[model samples]
Target chain A: EPEVTQTPSHQVTQMGQEVILRCVPISNHLYFYWYRQILGQKVEFLVSFYNNEISEKSEIFDDQFSVERPDGSNFTLKIRSTKLEDSAMYFCASSDDRGWETQYFGPGTRLLVL
Target chain B: SQQGEEDPQALSIQEGENATMNCSYKTSINNLQWYRQNSGRGLVHLILIRSNEREKHSGRLRVTLDTSKKSSSLLITASRAADTASYFCATDARNFNKFYFGSGTKLNVKP
Candidate 1:
């Protein structure tokens, strides 16, 4: 089965530096989402993208966060400034246009902000 | 924010036995989804039950959603050693397609 794939399975960055996480969603999917989980914590919604624009975003998706569908197949999340608290596993998921279809997740990018 | 809350944060069972996990939400939901994670890696989609549906089953896995009570349950029948993983319930936030996941239940099935 086709699945979402992310690049740079793990990243280590210093505080206040910029970091960009990349994802290649399923080719035919219409909606994409970004979520993050702190170690041993619940998964928190960050943002959702559709039609090459942000459709919905959570409060946790603050000024430092931005998402882009620069091309047809790539969805990227950029953090302008990393903080220690930003250390977590970032996941990318995608679903078809059919409302009933279930979302599939990628292996995830482990971001370690030092 | 996370709306679904699952109970029995951890469970251990012998292979061939059944494992059941429960979830409750604070608000109305369009659908409830279940996911499994092993060793803190990627999440694997298990099942999804719409608010209008009371029960659904896929192979040995069963899911039930009670919208009136705002609760749901996932049952893994005749479990195996590979069934050991953390199970989580997710619900979409109102008016948005953003999915919020609850604290997962860690299941350990010993062979």
Candidate 2:
């Protein structure tokens, strides 16, 4: 079965540095999303993208965070400046338009900021 | 008490037994979904039940949703050791594209 895939399975960055997490969603999917889970915490929604634009975002998705669909299959999340609290597992997910409610998640990129 | 909050943070059962996990939400939802994650792995989609539907089943998994009570349950019958994982319930609220996920229930099936 086709699945969402993410690059840089693990990343280590210095505080105040920038990081870009990349994902390649399923080819035919129309909607994409990003979520994060702090160690031992619940998964928190970051943002959702559709039609190459942000559809919705949570409060945690502040100015420091940005998402782009630069190409047909690539969805990228960029953090301008990382904070220690930003250390967590970032997940990329996608869903086709027909079953938009059911999301397929990638293996996730573990971001560690020191 | 929050949206998509599951009960019994952890559970353990012997192989061939059944496992039932419960989840509750605070808001009206468009649909409820269940996901499984093994240690340090990705979230795996298990099943989804719509707001209008009461029950759904896939193989050994059964999901039931009660919109009136704002609760849902997942039942795994005759589970195996591989069934051990963290199970979470997520809610897709009406008019929202994001999902609100529960804290998750950790299941340990002893073989």
Question: For all the candidates, what are their Cα RMSDs to the real structure?
Answer: 1.2, 1.1
B1-111 per-residue lDDT for model 1 (tens digits): 348899889999999999999999888888889999998699999998988899999999999999888899999999999999999999874544777689989999999
Per residue, candidate 1 scores C-alpha lDDT tens digits across A5-91 of 998899999999999999999999999999999999998889988888888888899999999999899999999999999999999
My TM-score estimates for the predictions, one after another, are: 0.96, 0.98
Residue range B37-107, candidate 2, lDDT tens digits: 99888999999999999999999999999999999999999999999999999998774578999999999
Q: Give candidate 2 regions above 4 Å deviation.
A: none
Top-DockQ candidate index: 2
Q: Locate the minimum summed-lDDT window of 10 residues in model 2 chain B.
A: B91-100
How high a TM-score does candidate 2 get? Answer: 0.98
TM for candidate 1 is: 0.96
On TM-score, the candidate that comes out on top is 2
Lowest summed-lDDT stretch of 10 residues in model 1 chain A? A95-104
Question: What is candidate 2's lDDT per residue for A14-113, written digit by digit as tens?
Answer: 9999999999999999999999999999999999999889999998999999999998779999999999999999999999896457999999999999
Q: Which pairs clash in the backbone of model 1?
A: none
